[model samples]
Target: MTLVDFATSSLSVLPAIIALGLAIITRRVLISLGLGIIFGALLLTDFSLLESGKYIFNTVKGVVIEDGGINTWNMSIVAFLVLLGMMTALLTLSGGTRAFANWALEHIKDKRGASYLAAFLGVFIFIDDYFNSLAVGSISRPVTDRFGVSRSKLAYILDSTAAPMCILMPVSSWGAYIMTIIGGILLSHGIADYSALGAYVRLIPMNFYALFTLLMVFAVIWFKLDIGLMKEHEINAEARLNESHKEDEDHVDLHDEFGVEESEHGKVSDLIFPITTLILATLFFMLYTGNQALSSSELPFSVLGAFENTDVGASLCYGALVGLMFSLITVFKQKLAPKLIGKALWIGARSMFGAIIILFFAWSIGSVIGDMKTGAYLSSLVQGNIGLHWLPVILFILSGLMAFSTGTSWGTFGIMLPIAGDMAAASDISLMLPVLSAVLAGSVFGDHCSPISDTTILSSTGARCKHIDHVATQLPYALSMAAVSSVGFIVLGFTASVLMSLAASFAVFSMVIAIMKMLSKR
Candidate 1:
């Protein structure tokens, strides 16, 4: 039975709070998410046992099947994960991965070079976060592994760059979607001083968290600033390398998600060909889907329009499928028998099964959170009387908390942006850009630290790092950047100057890093 509707209340947040606490204490993602969903369902059903059971059963069912029809978007994402995993397995068996690793080992030289290579690749792929998180990992893992770079470090670099770069680059899918939201927000508020594209550009510099987080990635690498749990991870990776004492060409990475059985006839092209196909094919499908959407809609037929209208999950599935076929062909060329290829496919699919399960529950918890109107309840706290000068920083922190609890940055954006716009219009209309930008910045910061965040999950999956390890190691970095950005927003709220705030924020970040460096040395 469908539960009765309820108004937004403080009870909406209890499930998330309990879930977050349990996740921290137990480090078991599924248990935390499942309990959270149950708690949310119980609250929705008003303590009725049968109704709560139905509420939860329906939530899980709805992910794959909703309204008596297959929920293709969620299913497509699941399919894409399995397809990508299988493709990765095929590449490993083809010996292409080994050949590429050997080749990269000769050129990449040291851990520093390997770290930078991963960082740059993560930044280079900005079209979409999921693609960025997984693609960069496959390409860089061999080199990073060869040089004893910790998987946690690789995960951090991936997580930091994926969303930050996508949000910063206006040509990206994220840019397209966010611009669409801004356009409507602009029109609804009767503000026509700048076009949506123009306003997005203006908010770029004001996105302190995104800008600073990017800086922190490279800075940490360059300065050898391995703080918190990351330090222990790096040390362990180094010790493992020393203990193995194997030559680069002979070494098999224990940390690699792909198993150690590699073909003897594999070449670098085996790796290069399939990956190139995936990138090119995904781009083609993105445009195709976007154009198809624009053709039937009121929007003009342009690249931006297509991106803004694209079905991302479907595009990822089609591209991954094409890439999988190509990778299979590479494996077939090796002529290593049909059984092994089938074996590789099974192994690949199995590897992703655990992650996919976590993703399903995470999505369910998100759905539960939505039904409870948790975001609305949290946002209501901010709508009370407050000083105008503190709004930007307050909004930034609130958005971060909301995203952190909900495990969805996009959801935070949907709830907070309109409130920020309305507040800006009511207070100081000139502060509109700063306030809106804070929501974007804070959401990314929260997403970085959130265990249930999709990007966080995918980054660990790509890096083959344990999920808790990634979260634990990256927390210090995200928190530091957030601290710096917090003060910057405070400056912006008072002065209304993006330049001054950035200048002030940079000074604070520099000092914080220096202090961290000294502490690490001690």
Candidate 2:
């Protein structure tokens, strides 16, 4: 509210916005995010040339080292990503992907089915958005291409379902982060009419952005809607398929021989073991984090302490190591040289380099935003002006804008959750309903469109497609969902009835989509 605070907040946002603009124009997400971090650090240091270098170093160090370092949860993400890459490499080496693609081609054999499968996988991996994006992209890309689905469309499906689905799942990392922020807000306000945890659980079913995104994913699959970059991909795929078909038998066989030479297939056990280890490890991690087994432990350290100390990154790293070892054992048992295992590991690590760089930049940017107090400053400006009844919708929009501008959903939730919770408490609104919903909606909306968003970048990277092409093609879908969510919140503000809010939202969304389709045809 103070001029200084307003100026600082405004200044903090500039770097992120510039980064986004640069990303949009250049189609380089990591570089854009890195620039945003540098800008934020410089701004936070008051543009003092002498202090700017220190500020940037501190920012990076704080994220990568201090307080258990970026190796904590981020490392866990990297571990999973590395594991995914290894799995993908192994599948690729073993020709499992080709086999699966051939199997899919024999069955569904169409673009519609491929799209639906991709969407369904997105929904199925609801436990974590990071996992969903990587897994869906890696697994479905081949089949989708075989069926003529565009890489942009594939990216859209992967990005659409990632954060939105994770936000709705109570047991995921996204839920834990939101809950911590909400708990802080509730404790500060001394208003306890609604249970912060329970409310978020209830609101998940009614979150218009989350639900609408899922719907749009399905709609895209069902309708095979091709617009913008998606249309370009479609044209390319069709042309490639046609060209492949028209090639002379000898020429085609020669090309196929070269391609087939690179393909390898693993035994069934090779596939099952690593995935099983990953699932069990993830479940154990979740249970530990959730404190499900706290009462059973009587060690010097409390169960919570033990859980906290159990680094997700460390766990994942261990798991990946185990997976690599298992893969080697399998290969050796089959009398294959151990050198092949090294190649698999090298290929997996190589594939994950881009993801690792993006993750690092995302974390650095988040740290810069935290140091600048951007969220707190923004929250102060809107605290009293937005009424209790209208806070949800308003905060939803604010969170969305912040997230979109910063291109970081975690940063958006971290900043907005406390502020929204405080505002809701002060206005006599239920802390859970407005605060949690706003955080969820805002995070999803931001991730949906922010050119610097990691998932956005990964979605493009996974599809091997152009980044801006994906952003341009997916913008309309994200906005349509946002518009529907905005109307849903407005209705909820008046009625506060979950069923009615959701029904009205779905109805309105369907009507809008129908109208748009009709207009397009005309």
Candidate 3:
């Protein structure tokens, strides 16, 4: 009803578009985000340069501190990133990385296995997308690197598996959050046919983008279908690996930026133990926090209930702290000098500085987007105008656009889910799940394509890939999956049959992949 109340009617989209274009063209993430933040601030401040400066400062302040208190969620995530970086350094210093790589080389025996390992790790770590991206990247990077798999490819694998897998599993933070939203939506619509968890599970078959994107990950690897820019990256990765082998023995590891030589006393357990501790500790805290939360509320202490109420940001921070301790213990066992350990810690924290800066700017712009009502304005454009049968498809596209513009999947969910539920309930009760599922599918798709997204940034950081390179290479795959899923949503809206829609989507996905593989051979 009050679309674009904060700024210009259509100018709200300009900042995001400018940011996205600059990111792709200039290949400088921070600059792009900075410019976007400035434009958004100007728009929010009615183009007054001085006022825009104030707006920017206040917005950034809000991100760091809310209601005169620390933004614990945001700050905790930042801390986790720093801790994870430190843990990674310790892994390297203790020679755990090298030993793990050597072990992978001997056991995997080929690049395909390495690729599968990356994909497996990505899917296996589904508790939170942030954790999934960073942990999988750390665990799989050494193996993937030894096999000459491109860092961009590893990032792609991480980005694809992290959010999609988490969104589908009820035990995951994503799933729990989505279910809570769905519960409110269902109650508001007065629908009694299914519970929130039940609705989510039923919608799984209808979430074409998430399902298709996931299968596409394995399909791309199995078919060797590296389309578009990805092929060139794979070629360059092999060349780089070959060139490294021919270099003299004096070649130092590029990641050893601290000038502290890694110890030769590292073993496979050095890598495994700390990482395992991180995972287990994170999971434990999630339940622990969730259960504690239930004690303060009326909710019972079921696993799903705990997950639904868990403090993800705090849990990740706690987990990282514990994991770092394990890494420290491992490093100490090797008798590495104290100076070297401190240097490793410094390198670890410093490596995350760029990511942290980008994240802050990204958050700042997101706040500006919210203040500008960009998402609300975008959703308003299609409301009450589309036919009922086309609602699902349109919502999927709309949700994708909203998420792409705002650079957040959860934000898109928050905005679109209620609108979708209201629309479906008013038109046809049968379409509720379809439309709601479309929004979920589209959000994940959009988040994948967005360069400013936290998941995208973290994926690149984890893989040690250039952020722009990862974005450029992953774009084609995301768009390809999105294209096929769009067609499926269209069919779904008309037929209202989950089985038929899934059958059609997968059928088309298979054909598209087959044709691409055939073309590659030629």
Candidate 4:
């Protein structure tokens, strides 16, 4: 085939490749994604500039209007995300988050305690990675800064816990969406109505990356184990604090420059009640939407069954709306003027504009990729290279790379899940769960480290840390976990026992951490 003919192939994944390259090179996700969308439109139009422009316009219009498949659910996610941004702004403006920080700082004595508290908050908010990143980073930044914990370290804790915890939890939005992908694949394979939830539950122990990533957060904190770039950042943070102390003895303030303004009247309950309401409302809306999604024949209802039927984006949107309403009521009760609350809400929504733009472009490229059958091409390419025994490890690595390049775990999941599911069903691999778990684990691992990832961005934004600094510091920690998890997946490929594999993986992680501790001492 000629060069032009080759480029026009139906399975071309060049648009995504170009997009990722642009993102990495320019460090501008929106521009990269927009370029990718343009490239995809051009490809669809056979390089006709006029047609490509029209195609691009239609794509954006459809995405915003929810006029087609996948975009509708995606638009709902965007709505909730904007609502969540508003909610976060209100919490910050109302001083609920600041009060919570004070409450945490009172008990958290020293840098180590502050780090653990930050990690704990990240773990606690498990509903959505976006929420987890925003809430934990904002809440923990003050306490972490109080004791000179690096913004990078604070970002690490926030990024590490967000997606990893979401993936491990079967009830979260991540789990629900993944289950749907698995269900579709299974149905295509003639396994009529297999329970994706049941499969996901069984695979939890197999998610070594998520498990190890969470544990490593504590291991690093407790052992004071700082390795690679993170170590340097922590040391520099201490040095800066000391320098400031000596230079301005009378002017020295313990508060971080990024610290939120405190409210003397703000109670811990101010933070707790609204957050609790958000979580509860999300679950309530999920279940309610799930119930409505089911057919009369499909349910007199079990929890998993309802989850399998759930409209993830719609539920999240509804939950966010409920949370926003409760937050307004709470702010009013706090004696904040209605106008102030309204202003805060608008400010919050405005803050999400950047994230919203990225999401739109991300979804656009995802649609392009889907239409091009890029995932299928990737699956085909990999299937020819690997034996069934090697499938789990290989898929893990491939999924990781895809997620790292794409900078959006959900988009990666949408691309890879069907491919992995179909491959598992077709191959003698017989162990689909391990492969699925690996995909989930790897996607999170990639997101944890990716400079362009939304969670990573939010973590830095939340901590008011330099974005590249957060990426640089978190990469070493993420790579450490990924190295250990890679070995764990290989072991699981051979043994195929989730419990035994988990135990073995945990042991491997401990050994790795022990070695790192010894090396750091040296």
Candidate 5:
């Protein structure tokens, strides 16, 4: 395609690509995305500075005003993230996280067990990728450190399972978003009763990346296989632990930046109560919203209306209130007054500002891409040439590369979902199986290796290791899984059986792991 042809087909895509490159090189995600938005606007508006400015304003307004302004589905993510931050803050302030970490350390003492626990928790929190990333990183970092697991490995586990697992789960926000896109594609192709939601549930078992990555996580935990930057972090942590032992300091602190020092008065009940409440509340809300049962009764203010009106702000407000109340009633009793609780709530909200800002920019870039039809144009171009048989693998790799470069799986999914869905329909592919798998796999792959990815930064932050250190160590492991997954896709494309494909993929992964272990020993 000529430059003009390419630009017209997907003008927003150029800016995103440029922004990703800038972010990777400079490690400044927000700045890169800002530039990307600008570039996308410029491309769509034909470099007319005045027109680009208008496009930018309209893009922002369009995103903000959709679905009752801030209450729209696009902004639901922002709300979810803000609530996650507040919840995390409350947990931190209550010493619940510290208590859990200490308990985890005591229970899963070995490196292998620690790794397994981290991966296990990741699977457990498959409701949302953002929550999974932040929660797992915050809660499991300390336990992993105690076992000499590298920070990068922790990040890898968190990032790998974050999007992959959630994308597979039908109840998650990721599922809702992808299904909507898939449904639209199905409708366009004259298919009726084709539920994108149903398709995702069926394809989960067959999703090569999700299956392989989960297996890889378990393998890492079980084998205690350390390579790349992870190896370096483990060696360093081991040396530090050894030296501390030799010195025999009376008050030696093993806690790193990512860990919380256990409070003497903290109890397991403190951790269990808030977490259980959070999970129950989230599930209740999701079911209530998804099923529309709350709308049937005409109360003064219907429950469904309240939920529909609820934004991230409302959710966080609710979570903060609940957390504060729980903290006072259970942890502090009457000693916790309104002022103290208010302060804690404010602290919790403020703590998530960084993440909120990142989410905003990520959303902005994605909005630009969607508005300018970059993804659709690209999808059309690709559809004309590639057969359905090979499209899945190509899209998987493409999604992975895009996510890796951008360091945002949500952004990657946002860009690829429509395109992949359209292609699946055009090529007569099983709309849900290959396309969903490709999006899920690609997103994890990108999050796995991207230096600027928030999860990567958090992993490094949690591990108390250098960020680059974590990325270098974890890249090899992620690549290995991706390779195995690619082969699995190739085999599945021809054979088209979930069980058979997964079985073959697992075998290949096992063999690869064995070879890597043998080579590492030498």
Candidate 6:
């Protein structure tokens, strides 16, 4: 039953193609992924319809629950999601988010300041992308609304910062997950000299897309450069606010779960304490897990070294569980009814149900892709065609397409890193680092733009913006940064100097922002 040994070359890529085609045409990720899995199962069963049906049933079962599947990692994600959800809900019920917004409103005076504050808060919460998106939107949405900042804009700030910041911060969940994959790839390709953390650190400066994307947020805020559908949305939001009957205008429920109702019992500490605890616990557990693993391996133990050796899934689960406990204690101290807390926790977990289902299907499809060796097949197509001068940009473009099509940057990372590592084994470290950085940057770029992406969905939901509106308004900004990042990657491919590439990229970003500002005025 080792499908990789028996997979037909012709049918290997068909499932992925079908899945992408269906996603674009139908705009339903669950259905597209399900169909992809069924088609892949059929191919595995040699087109025997009856056996294919049975195989589909068994495959999904194994992928989700049985040993040697994605169950271990997938369940860790699930636990993290549920715990984070409960924390958000507890904060909401205690009115900590509203209180924080009110406190923030005292200092953040205008629309521009509000936008910058949102961006700052988004960047501040970098432990987890999901937490960043939800926390930024929930806390800053009210303040942004007070200053006539559109929901679309809020969503943009949240979405833009979430992944980019996480990918940039080595202490983040994203960093740990990606490093694990990269480490495996390096070991598998026989690159024994380089450690995963070392490689990741080297790739950081060359992460043009993330750096440019973060800069774009600041530029957009500072220059007030609203264009395309964003301009229309902002104008419309202002109009609605002006015509409001209430002078305070705090009762805006743009969506079911958004908007804040001020509560006298709410305290800013309620919000601050849980988040602080979450961060501390996450970092602590990461080191703790790393130390445990390292002790067994007889490796020299340092905090940074521990991170390189840590079990990311286990650490995340442990941190989330502890964070949940702290949040519950805070909520109980606020004298909220036990039943109400329980209800809020359930509601929060329920809210994550859709994300969990998408993750499940994503993992299932990944299993199929692994068996088919789809990434290897794609790697075969480019074996020696990519010259050193073009490798970085080419990898960027390929990773971008893959992530955009699949709507999962993590999946893109899983697929592309090994190929990049294998390429590196045949080449040099200078080439490998930049190419891997390109892959990481491009993955975030595509995820930032893809409407079907989980972060995109969560951001829109959190901001109470129309999902399509969020995508349409944010596309221009994302594409602009992507264009700049591409140029930077190209420069790096040729020069192999990180400093030169970064300077060139920043120059491009500045020029593009100036152009955008000029266009906005016209």
CA deviation > 4 Å runs, candidate 1: 1-8, 245-260
lDDT for 153 in candidate 1 is: 93
| Model 1 lDDT tens row, 79-185 | 98999988888888899888998988888788999999989999988888999999888888877877888889999999999999999988788888888989999
Q: Write the per-residue lDDT of candidate 3 for residues 46-85, one digit (tens) a residue.
A: 6787888878888899889999999998899899999999
Please give the range of 10 consecutive residues that has the lowest summed lDDT in model 2.
Answer: 249-258
lDDT of 1: 0.87
- In candidate 4, what are the lDDT values of residues 1-522, reduced to their tens digit? 111222235346777778777766676677887888888777777788887787777777777766355566657767876787777776766677667767766887788998988898888888667667865665576567667788778888888888888888876768777888877776777765447767778778888889899999999999988887778778777776677633222122212221323345666777667767877887787788777766555667667666767776787788778887877766777787666676677767776665566666766776666555555555455657576777788888887876775566877788777778778887754667788888888888877766557677777666656666677778777888888888888888887776677777777888889888986676
Model 6 regions more than 4 Å off: 1-28, 35-47, 68-70, 145-151, 176-199, 232-262, 406-411, 421-430, 450-473, 518-522
Clashing residue pairs, backbone N/CA/C < 3 A, model 5: 79-312, 228-473, 229-473, 230-473, 400-442, 404-446
Model with the higher lDDT, candidate 4 or 6: 6
Query: What's model 3's lDDT at 193?
Result: 88
Q: What is the lDDT of candidate 4?
A: 0.73
Model 6 agreement with the true structure over 144-224: per-residue lDDT tens digits: 877788889999999999999999987776887888888888777767777988878878888999988998998899998
Scored by CA lDDT, what does every candidate get? 0.87, 0.67, 0.87, 0.73, 0.63, 0.77
> Over the full model, what C-alpha lDDT does candidate 5 score relative to the true structure?
0.63
Q: Quantify how close model 1 is to the true structure by its C-alpha RMSD in Å.
A: 2.5
Looking at candidate 6, the ten consecutive residues that score lowest on lDDT are 245-254
Provide TM-scores for the models. Answer: 0.96, 0.85, 0.96, 0.82, 0.77, 0.83
lDDT (C-alpha) at residue 202 in model 3: 94
Q: Lowest-scoring 10 consecutive residues by lDDT in candidate 4? A: 249-258
Please state the error at residue 299 of candidate 5 in Å. Answer: 18
